[model samples]
Target: MRQSPNDLTPGGQQRRAAIIDAAAQLFNEHGYHQTSTAMIAERVGCAKATVYHYFRQKPEILFEIHDQWIEELSAHVADTSDDVPLSEFLRQVFRDILQLMETKSDHVRVFFEYYRELPDELRAVATSKRDHYERVIESRIRTGVDTGALRPQHPRIAAFALFGMCNWSYQWYRPGHELSDREIADELFEIYFAGVRAESPASP
Candidate 1:
């Protein structure tokens, strides 16, 4: 009988997390198609059947990685208070992403690079979650514009630009480098904010 992942005991949950982390690292290092269930099982120091016991198939594992990555990113903006200044709010959001990237670099890579590898149904779910996250950023940008905190611009395009800046950082960002994640985050926010902030009225 197949055991449900939801019914996992605490130890079982830890084992499952290990499997996912191992798979994320392997998938990040090797392309999704190149990686196999056996490889994942070996990385987890368990039998392939044990891997299957946790996840019915590789795509389920892939989807789990995608879910974890997106869920963490979503959490940064979830239930954000409007009272928070727009600049500080967005700055903190980017800061959080950089910090997460530092800690979960492997998962972050799989998220941006291997999303299409998910099966159609899983891909759709991931796409929906990803799109929702983008909308949250867009909503915040629109609010900034409406509130005169940001310049009048297409919120959707601006949102994409913001994502482009932070999302691509995983490609080059590394911890224990010249700049810490927070410093990099602040620099990115300043650069992004410079472009989007409401322009001052011309000298009268």
Candidate 2:
């Protein structure tokens, strides 16, 4: 019996997902400029045209993957409460980013590699989303400064430095190695906070 589109069985859904997954993996491994749609189709065991049916072009597929990843990251960061101390909040933020990178390594690779390839309009959109994430860190730094928890410094610069430290981890962080994500987060936080935290209050 011929099945309608709505009647696709579990196997069909799995196959579709497999195609997307394969494309994402290949794009990450080889970079967008290097990976061809034909390669993606071959990896997915589908015709090149079929790959087009799912994604109009390589850039569209890359955008889709990036969109999904940023959405999830935004949600994770949004869930953090304002009540938490700055240090704890920063810890959670780092942990969330590390966990996402560890689990979605391919997406992370594609995100970093293809960011500049996006059109100006799309680049603006992507940057806006990223800036939203950065604002959270910036706000925390500002709060710490206001409360005298951290040394007085330019919040924006401090925030950028913290983000740079965390974001660059994708370059060298390897999964299944000795250091767990939590350990990496802890070490990173230690290095960052030790430098930024205010010195012991002058003896009263």
Candidate 3:
């Protein structure tokens, strides 16, 4: 069984986080199936038994990575004010996501690539959170549509397109590239907004 946060000492909490960090790097370098608990322990400079003390199994570590990544993103989105225009909201959210990809590349990789390797029960948790995140995006799109800020279209489809543009950047985006992450996010947002923006009335 995983150690409960309520029970863990401050040091214990740090150790658990260290284990997750080490495991994320290893998982990104070597496929999850190829990476072993022993490798994670070695990377963290702890014994394998110590890793087991915090997590019951390898899949638990995978779940931790996915859970933390999604929670961070969800929290950021939640903080955004409803008063902000959808265009501005998208710009902010996309930039935040790209910035995270720049810093937490391994975590983002595990989120996108290794989720299916999780056990059925654990996979369900990831799926549920992901579904909730998508719903949040769809809700914003729906609000934009109702307010006439966005064109009349399927909110769900619009949300997926937004995710596609933002999330897929983990595959190709690099820090210190010719275009900064913010620049890339802004350019992509413009492409998305152009398709969805409501048309203005004709001039006399």
Candidate 4:
């Protein structure tokens, strides 16, 4: 389990949060290797030691960034109830993921780029959470297929295809572009679930 960093005083906790926030943006903008601790400190307007005071190493920050996200996301996925109709549950799951990525696009980018940069031990922890994420989505897809709510297909392929639609949003999705996140997710989910072909025959 990742340490909460809650043992620190309120001020200390705030500083640590600020450091992670700055580091994620820098790491995402300038590749983790290109971004240095000094740049992180400069961005946060704190001394280099202060940065070190909160985190012993840059990898810890990367780990923390991933930790913060996966912990919350995992919790959300866990909370998804299987009691609902399979179709309803699936829509809820993707919308929840879209909301998360929209709210923390920078963190999403950092995780996408620097997840492998974490210490082996920390990467293992993150990897487990990712696996859990996959399992939850995969299970939902299988259930949908079994219930006739979805087309017959490989569950793992369907699961990752859904994941791809949400995960890739960090790359080009922006606020107030032509479409809202919900709008894009709605259309993407419609395509993934229903396919591109017209539902009715053409009236030629």
Candidate 5:
């Protein structure tokens, strides 16, 4: 029987992870436009054929990286129950995304840089996963509006704006510097909610 990917031996798994890590860093630093499979293999101390054994092409490696990122973000969002209050849930969601961005900064950077180079089919899959994440945020914003915790407005628009605010942080966020991720999330939440929530239930 053919072994599943998860059935790989420990050393095999470690080698695969190392290759992915090296590829992601190269793609991030040099961009997919400038990076090559040979560079990836060199960085990982593996034969070029070894990298090909795992990924058919450089773009395929990028697709895998993006797929893994989406899967992880989806899992995190899925674990958050709707039973939580909207405000708190939003807080959790923001913090979780920020943490993901921080942990996968290199991958995220490469994703944004090379996403356009993915084949049409792969791009569709990636776009759908991205849309799903946006929908999750929009759903929570809609819930907040329904519960009187947020102002009544277009949920999709609010979700997009909110996502943009948080996603753009990847461009400027620095680790172990001035602000912690939690502190940044808290400040952003306060600014976002204060402007969006209805005041006194009486304002025109």
Candidate 6:
């Protein structure tokens, strides 16, 4: 019988985790289509069959990457409520996403770059998760509008704009001595919530 991720022994579990980590790096460096199980095994210091023992195929690994991102992000925002000010809520989102992207940079890179390559069924599952996340953001934005904590705009579009701004960090974000994720998130939120141009007298 194939061992489920949770059913692995202690050592087996370690190898499985290592395989995912190595696969993420390899997938990020080489596009998903270009990466092979052999490459992942080599990176993990194991035989190619070991990867299959854990994941049925490369696409399963890709789907797992997407699953990890969505689940963690979902859990992070599960406590959100209108009781919190919109600014605080949005700032938290910015902070969380930036933290995840910074720490799991390789995973972020692979998720953005390879999710589309998943099989149709896996892709559907991923899309459902993505949509659910967007809906939560939209719902929060609507509440913010009703409570006058945020400006009026199409909530769905606003959610897309926010994610688009943050998700692209995978392309060029580099952690260094220059700035911290919080600082970057601060700048990003300031730009997102506050317009660049001066507000006109009649704006309100």
- Global CA lDDT of candidate 6, please? 0.80
List the candidates ranked by lDDT, beginning with the highest.
Answer: 3, 1, 6, 5, 4, 2
Q: For every model shown, what is its TM-score relative to the native structure?
A: 0.93, 0.84, 0.93, 0.87, 0.91, 0.89
**Candidate of highest lDDT:** 3
lDDT of 6 at 132: 89
Highest-TM-score candidate: 3
Instruction: Give each model's whole-structure lDDT.
Output: 0.87, 0.78, 0.88, 0.79, 0.80, 0.80
**Model 3 regions more than 4 Å off:** 201-204
lDDT of candidate 5 over 116-154, digit per residue (tens): 999988899899998998798898888777777778899
- Give me the overall lDDT of model 2: 0.78
Clashing residue pairs found in predicted model 6 = none
> Distance from true position, residue 176, model 5, in Å?
2.1
For candidate 3, the 10 contiguous residues with the lowest summed lDDT are 195-204
Error of 1 at 26 (Å): 0.8
Query: Per-residue lDDT tens digits of candidate 2, residues 119-195?
Result: 67777887898888788779888878888888889999999888888889989998889998888988998898888
Candidate 2: list runs displaced more than 4 Å.
1-17, 200-204
116-141 per-residue lDDT for model 1 (tens digits): 87889999999999999999889988
Ranking by TM-score: 3, 1, 5, 6, 4, 2
lDDT of 1 at 130: 92
> Whole-model lDDT, candidate 3?
0.88
lDDT of each residue in 1-118, candidate 6, tens digit only: 2467678789998888798888888888888888999999999999998888888788888888878888888887887765776677787888888888888888888888777788
CA RMSD per model (angstroms): 3.0, 4.9, 2.6, 4.5, 3.1, 3.4
